[model samples]
Target: MKLLSVNVSKPKTIAYDGKSVTSGIFKESVAGRVMVRKLNLEGDGQADLTVHGGVDKAVYVYDLASYHYWERELGRADLAYGQFGENLTVEGLPDDQVHIGDVFRIGEALLEVSQPRVPCFKLEIKMEMPGFSRQFLASGRLGFYFRVLEEGMVGAGDTIERVKPGPEQMSVRETAHLLYFDYDNLDRLHRALRIPALSQGWRDAFAELIGTSEGAPKKPRAAARAWQGFRTFVVDKKVPESRDITSFYIIPEDRVPLPVYLPGQYLTFKLAIPGWPRPVIRTYSLSDGPCHEGYYRVTIKREPPPVDPSIASGSHYFHDQVEPGARLSVAAPRGDFYLDPAEETPVVLLSGGVGLTPMISMLNAIVHVGKTRPVWFVHGTRNGLHHAMCKHMRQLAAENDNVRVHICYSRPRPDDIKGLDYDSSGHVSVKLLKRLLPNREMDFFLCGPPPFMKSLFQDLRAWGVPEGRIRYELFGPASLLTEGTRIPLRKPKPASGAADFEVVFLKSGVTARWDPDYDNLLDFAEDQGIFPEFDCRSGICQTCMHELLEGEVDYVVEPLDPPYPGRVLLCCARPRTDLVIDV
Candidate 1:
């Protein structure tokens, strides 16, 4: 087999992992000979050395024959060489025929086959396809990695000749298949363990799997996993639910089944915009039921920019710029706020404005599951003009005998009729809630803007609702929760001697006293004009992760995903003691 193309690329900065990342996936075929080195091609670079770029995975090669299959599968004839982020596009040497430790000579370079490529999100970013990683693994056409045995110049049309086959009987295809699908086949796994050419990462994985296996690999604990980064999704359709709200129907471009998600969970999107230095990350609630097939829907409101310009705004982009056929980078559905299907207690879904998104998900899930428990979907908005999904909500309520729908419009338009358009004409308060439902024993799930959430949360407490039964989700900046719940509306007189901790920003040469009203270190730092990079102040994004040089911090709430060992997410952590941090 001959090399069809020699590709190389320098790390190119792109928006990834909720921050700006330099990736080497945008490789281009070099016209002439390129120097092949022990670690990587002369011009090539890997952004994260921990995952890519090592002697064991110095070069990535794909068989040119697979391009034909992909061209047909993707229905595009314009697929080019180096499109799969391959360093060497060869005419032959598919995974099934390439065994671990097999040595080959191409041009003047001697290289050894190391392992099959374990696909990552970079593949998704390179191909602009969501679910590509899973699909690639399932296809069994995985390419093999090569470690240069002799550094030499190689170029297109170099003939690849097998010099010597190693003693290992395990082929690249066999190893990957065993690792991915036939994981439970301990006999084959044990055989693979003997292969000397297996990559260290895969070897460690296999070792761990074997250690954890009692005839079968144990299920991975959820807490131990990190976000798999963004996957590409296509907007199949956009349905206008109301004047201000529209629902985007997204489905995997690879046609894979949607990941299992509970009702009320949200899908976080990493939106790439040309002018923005970093991709804007935003979370939108899944508006459809989990039982819905072929697609997942997220309802979004077109939020107008606030009078203050500093606040981030992506609603305008979603409503105006994004359209059908737009490719979107979407994370898996995730959120702590969700309805428990196992619960038998009555459910009360309360919302104001677009907070109804999650409520709709919970309601649809209950209806789809044919749950017989009582459900109340109560919402308040400006009027009929601003109300969204009313028809669908009414239909579900009508179909389900145990479900009730209540719409309270604070202001009615001139043409709006009382009974037909709205059930009430005032803001939904404790008195109004009592009058409508009269039962305080139901599980209350609240979501809305700060004012709505704060008022309802306090009113619920005052009306004797159990704290455990009352759940709420604020739209943004979770620090609002601390402000709404902990800090009193009126300023309190200073205590005789309240202990204050010192927070020293070593880089900026600034220090600030930790005040009780400060929600977190990030907040306090921002106030002191030392704004560290931050996104998703709720602690989902690790953009604000800084090294804790000489300090201790306590989290206001445990983060969804923990930071790296020596780093702390300032967004959620408060200075527990006088500390120094490397921002």
Candidate 2:
């Protein structure tokens, strides 16, 4: 289906003169006709079938291109009007056509149509234009939630393409109504539940609806016999230089066997703090290699200004408030950044301040495994006093002739030299890097603050390091790093001669014919208004995880997780054969 129109509008609250519009005015404002692609509706009440708080009060809607065509031709803006909380407004296409598991690629970014929009009371106020909410209920043209699938720059006029389509018989709108009005509708709910396209929040809610009264079925008692309890042990070590950062040695209570992990992988720990709304899960990189017995080390740096002020002091809360005896819920180690032991080329490990954690792990792995590859470790810190793991790093270097460590200090105190060796009195610069190596064949592993990372990357490029050899880690929100630099958009290549393929949506029992050159299963789904939940279209985030019920596919890039035995990341995965997908 070709796009007919794209519209966007920013939501604005209007207060009437002495009328004091409460819910009604908000509803009336929601009904206004605006030609905008994104519309943010505002109100303050519970909307039916909303995931986040205030979502019910502030509804956003988008009209599809097909709907937009009708709206434009008939000059019927109300058909696209609704009190549903919508941050985006679109015209054209049947609302039911968008499915929960589908992803819409707009510009360089992607958005998954997570769930259907739920109308709020504010519509009654905005509906002042006419019978807006009633018309919306009658027309069944509600908008849906778009979980950002891929993050990048976005604006109006950008084309939208579906990367994955939901099963045909079950529509997102149908699922929304089923969830909103009749959550107990077992038959429809069962069908929606089987689609796998549903969001995790909706899935939990559905599970609660169906199985809440009775606790989740218990595992066989025999299964419990296999459970090994965890063992706990603690070893405290000082950083020598940085007192604010400490490394803790961990010993599990059950003494259960822990799996070996890649050097740069992180472990997620779920902590329950008193007075907190829910258990908080945080991930920290393993600061050392898997060693003899069951011990792993993690370094904690005091956060200067904790993002959540409720915690009083950021790092202090994690350090002083948290106790060693507290049980921590843990996730298995996961990461894609690892040193390739087989590459005989010289390797360079770069880090700044607390970014040294993963680099230390890599260095430890290299030393422990007795790899003979030449390694150059370059570390940058605010000053020698702020440098962490100084003693341990120096000891490792002293023991290994193949390893060399260079420390750069931005600001140095005369007495700070007591605990540091191989120290440089200035910031790391391309000139210094050139002076140190003079050669450019090393595989660079760099991680640090955004600015340091950016400057280092630029210098690496100028030094002619191949794109494939340079790998880095993003410690925070992927959005924090400027876009268009890390991963450049691939220019759409001219279609190779078309090849016929079939995509079987297993749940729907429908097979769609596709041309390899013209159809990307994901994009085609969005064009037909199907949206799948996804993030990091580059296959970094495991958001768009899906199983391959049948057939083969080739991934455009390496995925974060080893492709689940039978699954592929739909965002970057392409069919290598006639395919059957579970979603």
C-alpha lDDT score of every prediction, in listed order:
0.78, 0.58
For model 2, residues 166-216, the per-residue Cα lDDT tens digits are 664576668756654444356776677776656666665666555522333
For candidate 1, lDDT tens digit of each residue in 1-583? 8999999999899886457757898999998998899999989999888778899999999997788878877887877898888899999788888888899999889999888886766788888876676677678777989989999999999999999886666788998777654544567777777878777777766765555343221122121222366678889799998889999998766443344466787887888865778877777888876632547899999997868665457788889888999989887776667885535799899999999998998888777656798998899999988999988888887788989888889988987777777788888788888987858999999988888887888888778887778888764554454454653332444522343777788899997777767777887787688878876676776788999988777887566567888788988898766788886
Q: Which stretches of candidate 2 lie over 4 Å from their true place?
A: 1-241, 307-316, 418-422, 475-583
TM-score, cand. 1: 0.55
lDDT score of residue 162 within candidate 2: 72
lDDT, candidate 1, at 428? 72
Which candidate has the top score in lDDT?
1
Assess the local accuracy of residue 484 in candidate 2 as a C-alpha lDDT between 0 and 100: 42
